[model samples]
Target: MTDPDPFRVIFVCTGNICRSPMAEVVLRALAVQRGLASRVLSRSAGTGDWHLGERADERTLDCLTRRGYDGSAHRARQFSAASFAENDLIVALDRTHERILKAWARSDDDKGKVTLLRAFDPHASSMDVPDPYYAGPPMFDSVLAMIETATRGLFSQLEPAVRAPRTTLRALRRPDQEDLP
Candidate 1:
């Protein structure tokens, strides 16, 4: 049977305005393209509260727009220990965020759920998705590209489990009725 609940994922960065939001929207767009939109849930947060309640950085939004993904609705929020109970996966944009998240984890399970976003990218030279906050548009684009590659890899790993269960239709027949030819 198909599960009714969606698989929740939350992306984290130093500030919710950059890398994490980019990853969040990229993953959402990918889920939709792969037909797993209903089963997969994507969200983002910051390791710190510096940008809480603020929208994603304009450059981040611009990068997403150029790539055909939407980031207009994203609002910055802080990642807390309580978030562990709400998300199945907690993706950190960099090693710093990962370390912070791991420290906040209350149990082994919570610690296991926290991981670097680039961990899924087999070709990744580094595990961290660089922060492009102070960089120019070109850097934002580069970071978005990195996030896209890693997010795609992550989605591939999740596809099998999150995919809707397939079922076949059977013709109903009475106990005494012969099967249809």
Candidate 2:
């Protein structure tokens, strides 16, 4: 069997303590459910280093856990030019983070790879995944709902690109009954 092509994705927020980490976990769960986990790699980072080396905010972990997602073993990290080169897609949690990524991008090609996480949501015109850290639990729930919807859309868009053409061709082949006899 041929090795599958891998697609890397990075989610970014201000501190990597809330929005981005949540997005990473939610998207990973969605990808696994859709059987794209092995074809895709997902991680999260902060636009700044404020929370580098620290776990996601307790509230974020609690919310994710309650929603049936594992939030363990996540440590905050900062976005870097290397990550831009490594990731096929760099998703920013808000406009500010998007702009920061664009500014840090090494080239036009890298800049083009950066996008707002909410871009997949037609209803979210601003393309910003609102920060729920300062809000109540309901806000976090809302963010998760948005992330789930967007992640599903993202997976659907990527499915065709990652599907193995050989598999499809094999499935389309039919046996000759006369030859079998």
Evaluate model 2: give its TM-score: 0.86
lDDT of 2 at 98: 84
Model 1's lDDT to the true fold? 0.85
lDDT of each: 0.85, 0.79
lDDT of 1 by residue, 1-181 (tens): 5456778899999989999999999889988998878888999999888899999999999889998988999999999878999988898888988899999999998987887888878889999888888889999999998999888888877777676442221222222336567
lDDT of the structure predicted as candidate 2: 0.79
> Per-residue CA lDDT of candidate 2, range 1-181, in tens?
7656567789999999988889899878877887878877889999888988999888888889989999788999999889978888898888899888999887988887887777776566567788998998888888888887777667666666666542331111011112221
Among these predictions, the greatest TM-score belongs to 1
- Which candidate tops lDDT? 1
RMSD of each: 10.8, 9.3
Please give the distance, in angstroms, between residue 177's alpha carbon in candidate 1 and its true position after superposition: 53
What shift in Å separates residue 114 of candidate 1 from its native position after superposition?
0.9
